[model samples]
Target: MSSVEEFRTAFRDWLRADLTGEFARLRGRGGPGREHEAFDERRAWERHMAAAGWTCVGWPKEYGGRGATLEQQVAFHEEYALADAPARVGHIGEQLLGPTLIAFGTPGQRERFLPRIVAVEELWCQGYSEPEAGSDLGGVRTRAELDGEEWTVTGQKTWTSLAHRSDWCFVVARTEPGSTRHQGLSYLLVPLDQPGVEVRPITQLTGTCEFNEVFFDSARTPAANIVGTPGEGWKVAVATLGFERGVSTLGQQVGFRRELEAVIDLARRNGAAEDPLIRDRIARAWIGLEIIRGNALRMLDGVSAGAPGPEASVGKIFWATWHRELGELAMDVHGAEGMLAAGEPYDLDDFQRLFLFSRADTIYAGSNEIQRNIIAERVLGLPKEARP
Candidate 1:
């Protein structure tokens, strides 16, 4: 086997041996505790993965990582999902913000932040979406004013996932008062425990506060907290979006595949597998999963080859559509039981949660509409739509 393959094999063996004991203690019998405790468990898991040199597998060794190949990183994610390990809590930090910082941040910034992120010592949240800036990020109205050594930020950011539990937030604020959209924006790392910061969790249909609305009133962050040059934040934001829609999708696709398999098994036990139409749908779902896997491998290959491109947008679109279809198929197979939530004492309550969460796949990480527009304008050289 190749070096990458050997690493993957060893990693798999280690995970199989260690994950059960760690997860059992982390989750306890009734599942993780309150939100903070749950996040702590996830952080502990990340520390475990990092100690094994598996947390930031693709990062360079100088940055406290294994410097593993892209293939090895993909293998780690696949095995992690297969092992049913708890999802990493610092996803925004590890996948999106961390990569952006490594690429665009100064050496001092990297030294101070990267190790903490890999060790899960710092939890981070993305402050992108606002009441009016959900799909149109350029419409962000959050303002930041320079005050000698610090920047005072004031605004409301909606849909701030994990903000309540995060130690820091990477926020985009309008630094130039009269600048046009997308211009004069700056990305700042704001501490959440500061006096002027407020976070309110938004309860979803699942009765879980998985996301939040964050308000900043005269929130002050050191001017040195800016990730890149002040006026150049739009590029950094785009880079962060690319990582969010690409690498993050790879992890989700693997987890979704497991859910798809469980749905298939449930269908078989429920007699829905005998229906020709249902079989065909399940077959199509399998094909979709294969497509995602193949595209993700190609992406990893591109990253390894040091020529990353816009093809990750294609993977993002495909993965979202596939997840939505899988959820629909699960609901169809489960019939009435699929609609039941976890506390309903039903056979397929877990699948119901998956079904509900899948509804947001097309919306987050840039909406499917945005993805289609990107593919058409950037990839296919299509004519742009006229603004009203």
Candidate 2:
């Protein structure tokens, strides 16, 4: 077998053997709106994977990964999804922060954090979006000040996914008093368990609280925790965003396919597929999924070389808009039943939850509008958008 096929077979066989007993109950649990489900169990399962050397398979071998090639990494995600494995609890740390550290962090930072991330001993959350700076990360107003040996952070971050559960957060805060628009910012690694940090859960339309508003009042981390030079954090933060669109997203595409298949099956079972309009939409969804896969592969070429570039925005726009439309189609397949709760107090079936949660797919990470602007100015060399 080709090395890629061998790698895929090994992991596939491992998953087949391991996903039984209590772990079998975890399949398809804890993703997006359903993050509340089996979270502790999922964390334990991730630690189990870490123990078995199945986590972070794409990182360099020196960093404790298997040093899997890009093809093998893609296969790893695909097979993980094909096995219906539980949604990964350590993805934020393993995918986002780990790559960023490898690219920009000091050796000491890597020595201190990478092993913990590899082992799923520490969970991390992104501290990028604020009430005033959701998509425009340059507008971040959170500030951190170096005082003696540590940096004291004080600011509020909203839409922080999994913050309530994370052990640490990588924060982008203004360190220079008069700095504005990305300059003089620093990305600091802050512990979330400190007394100065308060995480308040925000219930979403799906009635889950995976997203949170985090208030950091004089929260502190060692001065050495900053990645890259203090004023150059914008560059480092952008690199982290690039890593956010990495190989693991292929696993997400698999989940998307599963959702599409489920929607198609529901339509068939409920006679909705008899409608020409429903049939057309289902076909369109299938076509869109194919396009999404192609765009993802094309985008990965850029990431494989280094941090991805403006072309990454193209994949983001395609998948986010397509997934949102799929959610709408799912609601339509449910017809009037979609509007009703599955039970009292806002309980939702899978389709209902998918419909509501996918509404934000285009809005978060970077809104559709912001992504279009990124492509226009960064990719096409168009004139910058008029700003006040």
**Winning candidate number (lDDT):** 2
* Candidate 1 lDDT for residue 111: 92
RMSD after CA superposition, every candidate: 2.9, 1.1
In terms of TM-score, the best-performing candidate is 2
Give the least accurate 10-residue stretch of model 2, judged by summed lDDT: 301-310
- The TM-scores, one per candidate, come to 0.92, 0.99
Tens digits of per-residue lDDT for model 1, 1-388: 3587788789889877777765656532111112434566667777887777677776788987777666667677777666666767867788787778778998888998999988888889999999988967888999999999999999999988889889999999999889767899999989999999999998765556778999999999988999888877898888888676544456566677778889899988999999999999999999988998888777765565443456777887888888888878888999986555546433325666667767887987788887788778888899976653
| Cα misplacement distance, residue 36 of candidate 1 (Å) | 8.0
Q: What is the lDDT of residue 317 in candidate 1?
A: 83
* lDDT per residue (tens digit) for residues 1-388 in model 2: 2499999999999999888899999999989899989999999999999999999998998998999999999999999999999999899999999999999989999999999999999999999999999999989999999999999999999999999999999999999999889789999999999889999999998889999999999998998999999888999998999989888889999999999999999999999999999999999999999999999899888887987788999999999999999999999999998989989888899999888999999999999999999999999999999976
Angstrom error of the Cα, residue 214, model 1: value is 0.6
